[model samples]
Target: MRRFSQFTCIDWSGAKTERPNGIAVATINRDGPPKLISPEPRWSREDIRNWLFHAAKTEQDMLIGFDLSMSLPFHDIGCYFPQWEDSPSRAIDLWHLVDQSSNDDPHLNILSFLEHPQAARHFRHSRDHVGDLFTGGTGRLRVVEQYQRETGQANSASCFNLVGAAQVGKSSLTGMRMLHQLDGAIPIWPFDPIPETGPLIIEIYTTIAALAAGLPKGKSKIRDRVGLEAALQVLGAPSPGPLSQYDDHSTDALITAAWMKNASRDKRLWHPTKLTNEIAQKEGWTFGVF
Candidate 1:
């Protein structure tokens, strides 16, 4: 397995604002515990994209994980949009389509894409306004998400369900735009070949990191210093000292960064048992799923 000098976890948001409180970033270097990085009071999607581009140039052999689905379920239905001929066939193309459709939206928001005539039919916009084509009780799940479910990990919100608090559709859409913008600056895993050096981006489920920290399923969100310290210690990462706040977003980023630091060393994760060439191209795998 390839070694990493640093690990980063970004808890992303897709709110339509200049700065979203849900966004949080944390990183761990070669020899210490992970610490939150807040260059500003709040971060926007564009801010993260710029920061990642800079990190890709400066950081050495880093693994960066984002808590959002990189692409929607394609293999489950044989295509992203069953009847739409214009639907993209690959993850990269999907990113391009999302970015292009939402190019005018501020702060990399994906409102335009959500409201697009064709795309709008695939997502569950609200409890009473579920799209006609939004299939399944909780929307479609990617192959990796199905694996997570079968293995007893915390259930991941489908990328097509934009309704409840657990919904990841908005975050995933906004994240796709960022991925499209960072196309050549940094290579995203599975979608792009793993570069021998420099940073690589991967889809991450924070709950998976929380599970690795010994937290039971469904109780993965750590929101207190005591809980945060206990989880960090379990990952063999030292204490980051007192934090200004202990919200789930901040704690999730911190714990996942530490988890990534240790988990990246496991060779099996780089090559999951079920990840195949087609899945890699259409629906990217989450780093810690396997």
Candidate 2:
């Protein structure tokens, strides 16, 4: 059996079918570069579900981190479906719809209808973009609260755009972390050392920590240009999802680049609470933070 087993990352673009186009997967074994799995022949929902169930069933302590938004008190995706109004009891009803739909074709299973392709298409096409859950409203908090009460599992998974954008670096960065673990360089914490945080937490956090510790802290310096470029190339691509197979080293490099951007003379406005307060009071980050 492979020591590291499978560390899979997916980029979900909300395609009509199950398999997305820009999807990528990477597997890391004991001490080796993250071998990229073929992007073609994308995986189906059934495949993913089966894999998840199998992993959960067999690996008592398996660490399966997905590059998607997970529902907790702070993050809510159902806000996109204002009509869903009811959560917990009402949310359960919506889950039934998703469950019912998922049964039709295991491959085309929709984990949540609110985040369905149809809804995404409607939003993308419609002139009046509906307010999303992140915008706050639609009683999403109440619904999520009820869900936590019933399931006792606060982490409800959903796809996110940022994960796909940061996939390249995330995948490589994760690979590096796994390698470090194998080499006994770092201890894998139960609380997950990687701290992208929020809905789409990726292993980039680990890479960032590594970079921060190794590189001189000159208000965020660029450690590696090549790695940063690769990361940007992936992020800049018009992809579907934010979760992708990113490597740990490259992930660290990208964080360094972001810091460099922060350190840039043009990016002065990004720092200092006064500028942010002034911007927030006067106009907004849209006018200046760019």
Return the TM-score for each candidate structure. Answer: 0.97, 0.38
Candidate 1: where are CA atoms >4 Å away?
A: none
Candidate 1: clashing pairs of residues = none
What are the per-residue Cα lDDT tens digits for candidate 1 across 1-290?
Answer: 68888888999998878899999999999898899998756888888999888988785578999999999999987899877779999999999999999899989988988889888888889878877899959789999998989998658889999987898899999999999998779888888898888888988889989989999977888889999999999999998999998999999999999999888988888899999999999999999867
| Lowest-sum lDDT 10-residue window in model 2 | 281-290
TM-score of candidate 2 versus the correct structure, residues matched by position: 0.38
By TM-score, the best candidate is 1
Tens digit of per-residue lDDT, candidate 2, span 1-290: 11223333333233445564433444333223333344346655445545444444454322233332222122233343444433322222333444443444333434333345443321212225442433322223323233433543222222212133332222222222222222222222211232221111122122222233343332223234444344434333111123343444334333332322222223332332332332222111110122
Worst 10 residues of 1 by lDDT: 38-47
Query: Global lDDT of each model?
Result: 0.89, 0.31
- Give me the runs in candidate 2 sitting further than 4 Å from their true place: 1-7, 72-85, 89-97, 101-106, 109-125, 129-290
Instruction: For model 2, give the RMSD to the true fold.
Output: 14.8
